[model samples]
Target chain A: MATVNWRTINIDALDPDSPANFDLSTLTATVAPVSTADVQSLAGQIRQLLRGGDNEGALQGALENPPYGADERGKDVHLATVIEILQSIRQSDMSPMLGRIYKSPGGTEALDVLMKYIYKGMSQTNAASTTRNITPQATGFSQIHSRGGGEGGGQAMSVLLSWHEKVVEIAGPGCIVRVMTDRRTV
Target chain B: MGPPEVHHLFHHPIADHSFSADRQTLAVARENNVDLYQRAGGKFQLKDELTGHDKTVTGVDIAPNTGKIVTCSQDRNAYVWEPSPQGWKPTLVLLRINRAATCVRWAPSETKFAVGSGARLIPVCYFEEEDNWWVSKHLKKPIRSTITTVAWHPNSVLLAAGSTDGHARVFSSFVKGVDSRPEPSAWGERLPFNTVCGEFLNNTAGWVHSVAFSPSGNALAFAAHDSSLTVVYPSAPEQPPRAVISISTQLLPFKSLVWSSESEIIAAGFDCEAYRLQGSEQSWQLAGSLESKGRPGVQDHREESALNMFKQMDLKGKVTDDTKLKTVHQNTISTIRVFEAGAGTVRKISTSGVDGRVVIWTL
Candidate 1:
């Protein structure tokens, strides 16, 4: 056994009941502005996206597997981005109905769940492609600027959602999100 | 630094060689591949090639007594291969780890060994039941940083890992029969490094390239990207790790540091030169710097030897307290060994470095 670097972190000394120790808090996330009800609503909308009758087949194909390290920074970035896109779509006047969808709390909840599945699908797709290669890939805006200082900040989720324009399409008065898939490319 | 007669030999073309645990077998993992060689008469000669890994095998470590060789690659896996009746063949492949594995080491008892990955620290265990190697243990949480070097304490229960992130991570070694295994806690610690990594993702010290423990396991020495060697009190759980002392200046990065078999003298190495540390205060005066034209790593070629640097020399440092360092050779030093292995002697110094050669020097 190697001499433990216990001096640096007496892991045993850390009380599970205590607040997060400042000693080991690296990259702690900041508080989010979304209300608890707003969060639940976004989760609900994403849940509807997974209903057995509504594009459940495509959703099934996408949710076939779970993602690893996808939760590394939590789902905040993903959800924020989803909200940003939904908001932008409503502002364009093409999806007045979509703007109404976000006016309530349930839509935000659905957005969170939708964002999770989308991120999960993204990770799975990337993993299958690089199983034999040497390094991990970056699939979103946050990751692109993950290196370097402060190039991306504030509503990171919003920034990433706006960045991937080709993957999404907003249509008509019925506020709807169209997630395009390219299974053939994989 | 005491006065000792040191000489440097010249080498040619490509240099830098590594030896097996028994000190008899030396393998050169060179520029595109690894070349296997054996000791014939007094020099090393081409033996056979051990090929299975895709990229150059940058690091190798042999388990004591077993003669088993483990090689790490840029291909994201550490392959445990052994030299058999036919030649080198694959035994087991430990996968899913840091893409770049810079170093590997085995415990003194040979039952366990460790590998250092680019962004994480992975310790693989040899399981006889499946006869395969698995990512048996590691830091509780993924370190998410690059690991550069690893070494085992002589007693064989403690293993230390150094990374480019500037902090050193240590793990406890487990024995086969021992009931009480000294496992590292769920989390690994982040010690300070000589320089600061300017990268935006993390805030730690500059890159720590190398680390070495004292003969008695009382102290640990480390080499960093900055031209310096840091000595620290390495074992504890209740206290914070603090640097006891550091040998640094603006000249060059000290690549390696080791203790004499007796635990009294310290040998330090810069990539091209080897020096010594003497006195109770551990004043790091220059000992021998390599002048060797021979393969540089030909210096420090013993298991029990705690000499640092490749086989080369310059001049000796004049200091008191039985801690003066004398010049050993003139070529670049790639490694250093205490000729007495663990005999606890302070007389013999062996080194190897850039020359890919090994040489023994006596004080």
Candidate 2:
């Protein structure tokens, strides 16, 4: 096989080991303050909404909390939690859900909206450096700024790209391209 | 002591490779054809191309003693090439399988060979004297899924197969007129065709990628998709194996592995590095990696000037040179073979990877 830029994992399509199995309660005690179970439950709700032909609702669900830029210095914790949750969802039974969504009415449009959010979120995270400009200077006292620096933003973008790759792998190249390039509708 | 011999052949993935007895000629299955490379003073040159197969050639084996080349492909066919006064003559073997042939191995005796196929059966083929053509008998029992790899025992009768069904099974391919029944080993006493001597599974039930037999033919080792290596030593047929020890690693799944020596094994795969695993029947553990950490004296140590940084930012997105991996192979190592071995141990090993490079490493 050729060397792919990203890692390829094969979760048995039939018996998928979903990311929902991740223990968020224990992880919250040590690292991020956010509840992982909440994100897992959110992904579950988004999956259900997408399956039920409510693609807009699913997109809204992903962007509502936004997972970052809300609390002070919460960007790293939020981004890491969101990335983990999306990665786990990628391991779920995605093909069937994607297929069912595409079969529903205005499904392509819904997929396009989701793709727009993913693409935009990834770009925003990559450009996180430009978003924050509090350079660390040599001083006993640290400068406090209203805007947080791009600490975990680039990693968040990378994780978003990883999820995008998995989604493309399941949805097929043509479908992904169609959704990605559907400009006027979005 | 020194760096391995590296040859960047082509852009396509090399499915399999075989070296001639004299070590002068190399045959590599690239795409639908096999390219033959001849060694000159220091480098190998493209000599010939075997272009009979219509589909992707999956496996290639060159019998050193007989100087014969056999290739199998995804087109559900196999061909045997014999060197003649004029050129290499191709004789098509009647491998009556509908699905693609996955792997092929020449037996020790050189009288027969085995072809693993997607049809869930292995075709143990031998040349029919009366017809002057190769004929095969299918080993159809107990195979649950597509056979990924086949390793022939030194005795030639016992064939070990690793399949997608997460099982490594040893079957007897003893043909009636091919040979005379001889000694009884730990595998079995009554040798018959398709007799499964021993069947082993990966601890995590992962797909078996590669299976190999020790030089002494006493131990069997297999690598699975779970990034674990299981070594099995059989005591007798229909009985629990003497020992089945599994060593799991944190590295990516290993696509290929070879027994460098009785106590050492070299496995390489998705990690882009070949690792040394050392031990015996009782227990086994990972030794260090076979690759050097970084490119010595080849670092881009030039001071990061503003102009260079701007140039780098304009050309590629990343400021650092993350394109090149530290290892010699930039991709997964697909096949690893004992390049040179003697006294029941391998002295040198060869690895071909998706990066279109073939490397020979001294152990």
Candidate 3:
């Protein structure tokens, strides 16, 4: 699986005052080894290097880099968890306020963010929370993680994930594990 | 107390037929003319003829909750209908899909829609958002070798797509257009485990002519070319397929199927036989068969003699290809649908085809 650089886009990039501007960012974890402390660290530093459109490195340093390792077959188990979380969230009726979602007038930014998360990797913990929430966003069973990217036309939209499912935990929002195939067959 | 048994509801057949959300109106497919019908006075009356399809019409659908009518065709286009004071009018011509479409279906909420085709060059399109308007996003590649059919979850953002290779795939009807800010109206299908909320279901005995999901979106029934009906549970991939029953009696195959709202009742059309699965008594005999309204049994002796007379024509040494396997019937079922009238119980179903005639039955 490809490792996602959690620090490529600054979490601070969003407006500090508006929760809408809050960035789901972390420290210079992209190039470091992950430990419980690395996972919990509040300060993040970005080591800038071109991987591909904000898609590179890991936020937390871990000997394992991407804790999920370089395995592809594990995607289905991860996907199954996604379904479970979605079902749980869908059954309930809670809608958490997402203070900050990339706002493209259309839906690409939100789309891209979701893709980036999928690409980055989904945290089993974060995923479980989203899945368990009974809010409209979690349970409606028909959500478009969309934004027009402020306007429309052509804008890049992607979802990355931090597979925090019991089976595997991925990283960031726009990062995808090269080996994992959640986009298909899952 | 059988005051009057409503035999069945008859639906008009053009090519593609879709039901409205509240199950009120139905739209029939026509190459250049799409017909909208009001269910009450008659099974299907010409409410209006929608134009814009430049070539043969391939598919038609009505939104589940709003009764918005959407149509797709060889013209490489799709149109969405909205309610107007005058009547249901074509409100949006949104965007044109590049591939010639074979089928179209709406998400349960009418918030999203899908279009599929046989052409591999073009991936299926599932449109959810347009900037200041609605725009379409697409699956990057063909889910199957040759896309043939697509159906959406009646109440959720899930999709069931069929391809010529006899495979059907279910996928997360992921909403499109995600920006940095959090979403307000997202209600997409959720996954239980690592598995996609959707899965690939049964392949048909032969090319599938049509597929229909129950009103509740609980079960899916598809009829194949061999006149066999395959009913499956789309959500439970863990369970084995429940049934793959054959609707014997037709040699050519079935063209369409429509399911009733309250029961497992399914009405299907074969060459000459219109078979339906009625009554949910929880028994195998729950299935009831309906013979063709006008099947010409074996031609009478005189007509047979006349046909034989024509067969008598011969160039003494003339070559002959395959002869008739069975006597050809004049009527072939081309389309089928089930809908509701104003009164909840007065449900209607109908069929039409080669005869170019329409028949309506009420339940």
Candidate No. with top TM-score: 2
DockQ, model 3, C-alpha based: 0.01
How would you class the docking of model 2? incorrect
Candidate fnat values, all = 0.00, 0.00, 0.00
Model 1, residue B211: displacement in angstroms? 0.8
Candidate 2 segments whose C-alpha is farther than 4 A from its true place: A1-186, B297-310
User: Each candidate's iRMS in angstroms?
Assistant: 23.0, 17.3, 22.7
lDDT of 3 by residue, B1-363 (tens): 111112122333356666566544667775566776666743545567778778888778776666667887877677776778986566444444556777776665566667776443223334444443445555534243445666655544555665544444555545534322212111123432112333333322244566666665666666554334556553244444444333322133456766665355544454444555653323312254454232343332324354455565553332332242221222566666655444323266655555444455554
Per-residue CA lDDT of model 2 for B178-290, tens digit only, reads 96684788888999888999988753456788999888788999998767789999988788899998865646778999988889999999888899999987899889899
**Residue B5 alpha-carbon offset, candidate 3, angstroms:** 13
What overall lDDT goes with each candidate model?
Answer: 0.48, 0.77, 0.45
RMSD of each: 22.2, 16.4, 23.7
Q: DockQ of candidate 2?
A: 0.02
Q: Over 4 Å off in model 1, which ranges?
A: A1-186, B1-17, B131-135, B140-144, B173-204, B234-236, B241-243, B262-271, B279-332, B346-350
Q: Write the per-residue lDDT of candidate 1 for residues A1-186, one digit (tens) a residue.
A: 989787699663575522244343233222234344544454455555544334332222222221212343334433343433333332344234333433344442232234344444445434443443333555555444443332233234343344233122321111111111101011
